[model samples]
Target: MSTRSEALLARPAAQLEVRQRITVLLTPPGLWLLLFFVIPLGVMALFSFRAASFGAQRQVFTLEHYQRFLADTSAQRLLWRSLLIALETSLICVVLAFPLAYFLSFRAGPSRLMLLTILVIPSWTSFLLRILAWKVLLGSSGIFNSLLLSLGWIEEAAPILLFSRGAVIITLVYIWVPFVALPIFAGLERINRHLLEAAEDLGSRPWQIFLEVILPLSLPGVLAGFLSVFIPTVGEYVTPLLVGGVDGIMYGNLVQDQFARALNWPLGSVMSLVMMLVVLVLTFGLGRGVKVTDLAGV
Candidate 1:
């Protein structure tokens, strides 16, 4: 073969080899996701349309679960309540986390790693254990009530502390702040210090600089934090189950009841699918909205 023709043939062979190597590298994780995530999701999707049977097994397919969920007033209320609580939790986490994130990113000096370690320490413990600790702290005879009694701040140990919506919200906020703040801190750290200096050089006040430079740049972190907190909070069962009392019960609790107590797999699968869809929709919608908002403001 001519030298040029031989080089052309070699190039295609090299490209094929590279493509094969890339596919081999990606195949394992792709198969893992297919086995663990995609297959289960497919099964759940198929089962969502199946009928729930009691004493006798039903081999028929139906939309009874989805229809019932849509038509039932209590179920609808629970869905809305879950959405509201998750939104509120995300908002509060952002508000509380921003300052801490900013400080950690800009002002922590040599202790930044140490402070971050402290923030993450709680997460190393079991989630249920943390919730149980909150239960103890907020119980009528718990430390909070005891302190109030000793200080004469309350006439008696308040009965509304544990098993209340407030307790649920408080516990959620405590658990999720680290998830939100760490992302925000990472986003803040990526911001160029020169930009802030240039904003100040232009006679921008601190607030102006933050609004113009810092906030806009840190948005990726903020959005990440919101998603991390909001998505899981919407499906939160444990915190609400333990501390929410009757009033604080959320959509997830209902789903859990269907699977565990009611033995209604089809119905539970429907609810789980619905929750997953909502999370997916919110993720795309909020991400687009954030991009638009940033562009419009800028």
Candidate 2:
């Protein structure tokens, strides 16, 4: 046989080996997702359609839960409120994180690792503890109120500081900023330094270079970080529970109340599915506008 024919014949064996390797690598994670995520989601969907009864002799499926949710103005308001708060939180995190990320990416130099470690250290603490810390800080006699009192800024502790929608947004922004910064930092790091140098050589000012080059390139990371914060915050119940009080109640709170307090699993499932669908839609919509693959330098 000719050399080309021998190589072509061997190519099938090589291709089979590669395929086997890929299957071996993907099998564990694929099975894990099937067992945990897909199965649970399917169960939830099934429950959503079923009548809200645990020990009924007959099983009936209906769309009344969804119908009720759609008709409930209060529930719809809460859903909109939750989405707005999540959007606000994501925007605030992006605003605050961008500066820190920029500094770390371009200015940290030898102290980059140390600064990044410091930035992430607080996140290593328990999530509940962090929320509780914010609770204390915003409380009547907390450090914030005390500082305001000592500084003669207020006659008394501000009741608006804790147990409100603002409190929920503030706490969530604080919690998510570190995580948001990491992606922006990664995106910034991936930018070709030569681009900036070339811009400088072309007489572009610092602000011009940032606006023209850096901002455009780093958008993917910004979007990724925004989605990261926005999606979870929309479904957040714990932070609002601890710090938001009655005023800060979100859509997720309604779901929790149905499942835990009201024993209405079907309604909760319906709400859960609706929230998931909304998030998926928003994510897909945004994905269409800005490709997240750019964040990975793909």
Candidate 3:
């Protein structure tokens, strides 16, 4: 009887060891993702289906909130405007980031890490503070105007830089610039310098090399960076609220209003879900176009 008990214990221990090893390789990441991503999405979905009374603390399951979001012309206009602004911001970010990344990868002196760090320093500081800094720099009494006046570039301070679409775009570009750069840098870094050299050796001009070897190789990075910034930028609430006057209030602002002032949770959720689908489609499309988006590197 004692021998049989000992044999059973030994069998379980080996199985437990195998299970532990398998779990060690997979469980931590799975658990973390489940806790953070899945849980938040689940909560959002749950609340999104509920009709919200907000300050009055009343909620009930209903489709009225969603119907209102779809049927209201004002809401649709706001949503369209928000999407357009976000798209503009992303395009600007991509254009600015690509060249900087290209230079950093192909040129910049040997202190590459230092250069990257410097480029990202502005981002390390407070986001709100950065936007405020833009406000001051662009204000009537700001340094930009004073400098122009001192240099005689213009007789008066240009007051055209504040509280408008231009202001919002400039601030957003500044804020999202680093996000765009890092992914591009990562993409460029993964590139094989040898392949670029080979293209050059084959009498490919610098432009040709970029068009053929560099561009294709870096597609993944470009996409990764675009999606990283684009999705969140679409739903941005703060930049629109702060820098955008009448022209700058984006769809995110509408979402906040619907929940807080309008007491419409279902509609907010629908908008959120629609935004998610748009992002997902963009991501998948980008991924398909550049299969390397899933690759370990260029």
Top candidate by TM-score: 2
Clashing residue pairs for model 1: none
1-298: candidate 3 lDDT, tens digit per residue: 8776556557978668767878898999999999998997787787767766454434567776567767888877876777777778878898999999889888986987799889988888898999889888878888878988999999887777677778888898889888888888888988888998999999999999989999989887887777767778878888877777777788888888866776666677777876777767866876665544423222
Write the number of the candidate with greater lDDT, choosing between 2 and 3.
2
TM-score, per-candidate, Cα-based: 0.88, 0.92, 0.81
Per-residue CA lDDT of model 2 for 1-298, tens digit only, reads 5776556557988668767878999999999999999999999999998886486711788998999889988988899999999999999999999999999999999898799889999999999999999999999999999999999999989978999999999999999998888888888988999999999999999999999999999988888888878989999999999999999999999999999999899989999999999999998888665555543423
Window of ten residues with lowest summed lDDT in model 2: 289-298
RMSD of each: 5.6, 3.9, 6.4
- Model 2's alpha-carbon lDDT is 0.90
lDDT of 3 at 54: 57
lDDT per model, in order? 0.86, 0.90, 0.79
The order by descending lDDT is 2, 1, 3
Report the candidate with higher lDDT, 1 versus 2.
2
lDDT of model 1, residue 166: 83
User: Candidate 1 regions off by >4 Å?
Assistant: 1-18, 53-57, 289-298
Better of 1 and 3 by TM-score: 1
What's the lDDT for residue 229 in model 3? 72
Q: Order the numbered candidates by TM-score, best leading.
A: 2, 1, 3
Identify the leading candidate in terms of lDDT: 2
Q: Cα lDDT of model 1 overall?
A: 0.86
